[model samples]
Target: MRKNFAVIGLGRFGGSICRTLSDEGFEVLAIDKNEERVNAYAMIASHAAVGDTTDEAVLKSLGIRNFDHVIVAIGDDIQSSILTTLILKELGVNHITVKAQNDYHEKVLVKIGADKVVHPERDMGRRIANNMASSSVLDYLELSDEHSIVEIVANSKISGHTIIDLDIRKKYGLNIVAIKRGMDIIVSPKANEDIRANDVLIVIGTDEDIDRFERKVMQ
Candidate 1:
């Protein structure tokens, strides 16, 4: 079954989520205290409303509990964010995801039963820093504080070498989960598979090990 979603606060973060979910064919209800923001999403969302979500009556009236998941993306207003999440929990909303401003805000949201908390700004900063640190790195995803999955372009130095010849797993302590070559994606490439120049390697490892591999091989 398709899940119904309600996104409270129509700032850049919440607006992006609403649009993406709607584009993916999910039913999304967009809400904001500002009438202008609500009107802007009226044609984009399944429903759009200008109402204070912190008010229990407003939430109940909107039938918020019936939605499968709720996203609280209130920007800068930590108190309103926390209050809305608390009300959603009290109303027995099945899943609640919130955008947190800082560590303290995240802790409070989690304590109040938020199913997920996202730090978009902080995460994006880390991703950008990783990309800038290595020219070969095409993209980066942080699995944890110490572990990451990065897409790295194979340079001439590592080209024409087979997985077995490179002994990447043993030498770098990293796993090449997949290889993106042109339009083809080789998942769990065989040991004899040769890596060509410009092939994107999807590698996962600890940050320390990945940095070592990038310096020694990619450089």
Candidate 2:
């Protein structure tokens, strides 16, 4: 069965999640204190309501805890965000994801039993910086503060060499998880598989080791 989702706050981040989840065929309840914001998403989300999420009575009336997953994306209002998250936890919501405005906000959310905390702006900035810093890096996904997965295009320096010949795991402490060539993708490529120029390598490793590999092999 598809999971039911509830998104509190119809701001940019929350609206995007609501729309995407609806497009993917998930039932989503979009809520916001502003009637206009809720009205705007009425057609896009499975259900839309205007209510003060920080108020326990309002949240209970809306049946907020019934959803399988709840995303608290209140923008700028740190108090409302924290209060709403705390109420959701007390109500026994299965999963609660909150957007943190800063490090301190994240700490408080974690302390209040938020299942997940995200800093969209901070993460996006890092992703953009990582892509700009490397000419061959096409994409970057941060798994944590210390590790990441990057898609890098093979160049002359690393092309035509087999995985075993390059000894990527031993030398750089990175793994070539997959290779994307044109329309096809090779998953868990063999050690003897030859890498060709223009192939997109899906590499995973610690951030420090990934940087070393990129500088030593790609450049």
Candidate 3:
């Protein structure tokens, strides 16, 4: 079944979610207090409405609780964001994801029953910093506070070595889940497979282990 999604607040964060969900063939209701913002998304979203989500009556009128998932992406207005999330929780929405402005906002949202709280800005900054920290690191994704998945270009030091010869799992406590060379990708590469310079290794491990691997091998 196609999931019904409602995104409150039609700013950059909310607008992106509405557009992406719509692009993915989901039914998205884009809501905002600003008529201009609502009208902007009318053609792009399954439905668009102009209403202040902080108003309980407005939320009920829109049948927001019936949606499978609701994203509260109110920007700048922390009060409205918190109030809307609180109202959604009380109305028994199955899932509620809120965009928090800061750590304090995240804490409050979690306390008020938000199913997930995202700090997009902080997370993006961390990803960018990690990519810049190592020349070989192509991309990074944080799985948790302690663990991450990273794509790193194989350097000359690790090139021509087989997985068993490198003993990466024992030496660095990291696992190479996949290897991408040009357009070809090898998933769960065999121990005898040889690594070539410039091969992109999709590795997963604790952040500490990944950093150590980057410093000792990638450098």
Candidate 4:
């Protein structure tokens, strides 16, 4: 099934999102104030409109609330971003996601009923830094402030052992949610499931526990 997504602000982040969503068979209405930006996405999105998203009248006219998810990806302009987010919330748009420029902006967006807030620049920076700093670690996804689900290669010691033998849940408070072996993915792997060497473990746990597991079992 496809979703109707309204993407506001056609900067790098918003543009990338709009194009990808369209490419993935989503109905995307991409909005941007700049003529050049709107023109850039005109052929890509299902609909491209040049409008000041901060204006409630324009937002209402566009029927933005009808979309399943409205992403306020306004770039650089902090005031416009907050105002647009507020308008989206006031208009009763479900699942509003706003891009936060900084901590202060995030606080404001949260207070205004943004269902989700994203710090793209900071997050991308952290991921790049993490990748640069670690060799064993491949990727990281933040589940919350304290918990994370990471994709890491299994170490030799823990490889070829069943999930029950590893005792990951009890010993480390981590869950081997799945095993990605070559092209196969065993979702919610059985307790007695055997893991092979070179298999990727999609594990979920607290940051500290994940780190410990990584150092001990998944070096």
Taking all chains together, each candidate's TM-score versus the true structure is: 0.60, 0.60, 0.60, 0.60
Tens-place lDDT per residue, model 1, 1-219, is 667889999998788678756654568899999999999999999999999999999999999999998989899999999999999999999989888999999999999999988887864434643443457999988898689999999999889999889998999999999999999999999999999999999999987788778878886
Per residue, candidate 2 scores C-alpha lDDT tens digits across 1-219 of 667889998888788678756754578899999999999999999999999998999999989879988989899999999999999999999999888999999999999999988897865434543443457899988898689899999999889999999999999999999999999999999999999999999999997898778778776
| Whole-model alpha-carbon lDDT for candidate 4 | 0.81
Q: Alpha carbon lDDT of residue 63, candidate 4?
A: 89
> What is the Å distance of residue 215 in model 2 from its true position?
39
**Sliding window of 10 residues with minimal summed lDDT for model 4:** 124-133
Clashes of 3: 0
Local lDDT at 183 for model 2: 100
Q: Report, for every candidate in turn, its global Cα lDDT versus the true structure.
A: 0.87, 0.87, 0.86, 0.81
lDDT of 4 at 85: 92
All-Cα superposition RMSD per candidate: 12.2, 12.3, 12.4, 12.1
Model 3 segments beyond 4 Å from truth?
A: 123-219
lDDT of 4 at 194: 89
Which pairs clash (backbone N, Cα, C closer than 3 Å) in model 3? none
Clashes of each: 0, 0, 0, 0
How far residue 191's Cα lies from its native spot in candidate 4, in Å, is: 22
